[model samples]
Target: MPPMPARIIHTSIARDWREVYAFMADHEKMPLWASGLSAGLTREGEEWLAPGPLGNARVRFSPDNDYGVVDHLVTLADGQQVHNALRVVPNGDGAEVMFTLLRLPGMSDAQFAEDAAWVEKDLASLKSILESSKA
Candidate 1:
């Protein structure tokens, strides 16, 4: 059988999927929660340049969709592309947001685990931000 994604991290946000998707679907807003892009983003057409620990990197986020898909591909200064598969699904009155993290080449097992934790933290931040905004 084909291998599954190395890891899938997720969280259920208190806000409706519409609200969650409206926030997450904006690629330019990613740095607010995404640790890797703490310095935020600048865009030109389909390409987005986000400041990274190493340097500025280019990215391409999937176009907004009615179904709440928020995937993206990031290209570092070294020209390596990393695909991040993310989705938001309705769960009752709230939303379930999931992130699929793949094990890339040269990543150690521990590094993969750490990446999952990082995703969890980021998702939690997203949850906090969205839920708080309603206050």
Candidate 2:
């Protein structure tokens, strides 16, 4: 299969990389910044169930680690799994958070652009929340 087009949407935060990672590593806190999970997530065993575009979706997050990685796989109702790659790394005294978005099969140019814009907006939301919070 051919590689899908990808976009690395990111934002800079005026906070320590470790601090940013710590805040984002908590799955339950996603709803605070992630509009996609604005309806919130419910933990069921190891996976989390969140309201999807179509229906409830199961989300499996990457295990905790010293390195900053907040990857997750969202399983849609139709069993389509979308893998989201997120990372936090040092940017001088601040931090840089990045999210990789892929243009899936059958997606149109307009749809892909919209998805990228959504990711950019979400990252901005995250930056706002973290930057405004007390360290």
Candidate 3:
């Protein structure tokens, strides 16, 4: 399967950039936005665990505030591995989030597409939460 390219999602929230960034970076708050996610980061050294309704997996994230990027590795429960990257850029009134979910050697394209769609919906929920909180 071909590696999935970065999917960009943009939205305007009433909250400030700092608040928006903080909300996104807070792992514990993921289930509040992400669908079917039961818990957030479970760290073991540099690696972090992300558990959802599907299964539990480990990933490593290196945050670069200067470049507004996070380098990560997404390892499937069955031993498949994919290198992922996320970049958050400040827009005119809000922020644009880009997620690059690379295709692993044995990963199916259909699964990747499904996951991408879920992520898109998650971001939309996040935008709504942030915008509504400001009102």
User: Which number leads on TM-score?
Assistant: 2
> Across residues 15-78, which tens digit of lDDT does each residue of candidate 2 receive?
9999999999988899988889989999999999999679999999999988899999999999
lDDT of 1 by residue, 44-115 (tens): 788999877787788898887999899989899898888889999999999999999998877888998999
Q: Rate the local accuracy (lDDT) of all candidates.
A: 0.87, 0.92, 0.67
Cα-based TM-score, every candidate: 0.92, 0.96, 0.71
The number of clashing residue pairs in each candidate reads 0, 0, 0
Superposition error at 65 for model 1 (Å): 0.6
TM-score of 2: 0.96
Q: What is the Cα-based lDDT of residue 84 in candidate 2?
A: 96
What ranges in model 3 sit over 4 Å off? 1-14, 52-55, 103-112
Per the 3 Å backbone cut-off, how many clashing residue pairs does candidate 2 have?
Answer: 0
Compared with the true structure, what per-residue lDDT tens digits does model 3 show for residues 1-135?
554455554455556665676776665675688664457677788777888565888877666366556556768787777675666677766666666655445557787678777767777898888888852
Positional deviation of residue 135's Cα in model 1 after best superposition, in angstroms: 8.9
Q: Find the 10 residues in a row with the least total lDDT in model 1.
A: 1-10
Better of 1 and 2 by TM-score: 2
